[model samples]
Target chain A: MSSPEVLVHLHQKAVLLLQDDANKIEKLIEVQMENLATRKCPLYEEVLDTQMYGFSREVDFAVRAGLIEESAGKAIISKLERNLAQLYEALDQKSQLL
Target chain B: MSSPEVLVHLHQKAVLLLQDDANKIEKLIEVQMENLATRKCPLYEEVLDTQMYGFSREVDFAVRAGLIEESAGKAIISKLERNLAQLYEALDQKSQLL
Candidate 1:
């Protein structure tokens, strides 16, 4: 296959995976937030570590192929990281209350 | 602040952070992939390690809140993990080529 085709193929796969993953992550954050509010586990979810890293790989490939903007890709993952931090903060607050 | 309001606030903040973070991560992955494809780095991006773990925390919180279904949350993370695995496969393929 040509380089362009390869790029498109990779980009398409990454985007598909990304869309599904993003939705799930968004929902996961929502649930985790509720848990903190109700005073559940004080600890943060530990699964995201692998997911984020995996995502980074896809982003790297996509940018190289020109399928996605570098800044745009970074922002997508950063949002998840930032919100994750926020969740950590809320969890900390909830723990203090206990 | 009331519980619901606090939840809303946390959710909003998390969402904003998440959006930004996601973009960054996606870009990071793209770059890393290029590095690998070019033989610049035989190893995968180490930066992703921290990000994935951090994301896990958010997922944990969202799951607790009922904002995300459990299977859904797992799937989100799993997709990244799978792609990461795919990258690893590519790396392995390249190594074999060498």
Candidate 2:
């Protein structure tokens, strides 16, 4: 069994990781925008899918690892999913504009 | 020029968005792992690149927008980049392991 401190540490680390992943994804979006501007193929889609799925799993793991409550994690993840969807839509629109 | 409050709000929003993006990336990683387990092609790479670039740009924008200081933004973005690199490595290793 994991100690409470260990669990807390893992939870905090997961949160930090999640935050970092989000930053990376946003950067990818910016790149996509630039690619569109430059008439590039927007080949970063595979990477984005990997990172997004990884992030969601980490959140779920954090909840299972006893670092966060399921409700809170779900709420946060839901908000994140919504934001991601919006970002995806934004990217799609930019692609169409190109 | 933006008001201080407006700047702060934007900065906070950027941070929150960054965090959410990070969460999404992690979920993507998990999916990649599962896909590898199931022999999927990991087509999310494009999306990851777009998001990572977008997130970095947002951080830079936040700094320029007076939402965060350059030093703090740089530090945060740097840490995020490092974490992202680690996560990428981990995913690569996992892919190879499959």
Candidate 3:
């Protein structure tokens, strides 16, 4: 019963929402890294572990919710994972610098 | 007094550290989004706001530390900001869905 325009609007909105979630997750990862580097807190590791799990869940949810095609979700998740690996390497270098 | 090879190694190490920090921050953001979506917690907003600020600081520090070229640092920060804005939108949508 929805018009094409309305459907398009809904789709656009959903895409925006998914993109926003990805951004917030990115910020969270940065904050945790700072905490880990500065405090050497044990909780830092826990936070990182939890965040990784959350990233997986988010990717799954995006696909299941039909917010992204499975191929698109896989592509995005794969890129994210690569970025994450690089980030870990960066942190290790920072520790060495300190 | 440093050899070119050693300098290259140092540069690589620094780049690696910054990348690691970025990845960890990304993970933290994901956890916060999930928490916000599920719990309607005020703390979630606080976490996001703090994270954005942290991202800015990190980007600034990365530049000051000579960890990245100024142009590259600016590009990265701009991208991060755009991503954070998208994340806010995603969380809002998630709330609406709930």
Q: Which candidate comes out best when scored by lDDT?
A: 1
- Whichever of 2 and 3 has more TM-score, that candidate is 3
State the number of backbone clashes in model 2.
62
lDDT of each: 0.60, 0.59, 0.58
Candidate 3 lDDT, B1-98, residue by residue in tens: 23445445544654565566556667766676666636666775676566555555444444543445788767766666666677778877887887
Compared to the true structure, candidate 2 yields what TM-score?
0.39
Report the lDDT tens digits of candidate 2 across residue range B1-98.
Answer: 33444434445665665567566766665665456545445456666665666556545544543445788778766765676576567667777887
Candidate 3, residues A1-98, lDDT tens digits: the string is 23444434434554565455556657766776666546455565566555555555544543543435788767766765666676677677877888
Q: What would the DockQ be for model 1?
A: 0.03
Lowest-lDDT window of 10 residues in candidate 3 chain B? Answer: B1-10
In candidate 1, stretches whose alpha carbon ends up further than 4 angstroms from where it belongs are A1-16, A37-44, B1-98
Docking class of 3: incorrect
> For residues A1-98, what per-residue lDDT tens digits would candidate 2 score against the true structure?
23445445545655665566567767776666555555445457676666666656555544543445788768766765666577668767876886
Question: Between the candidate structures 2 and 3, which one is better when assessed by DockQ?
Answer: 2
Interface DockQ of each model: 0.03, 0.03, 0.02
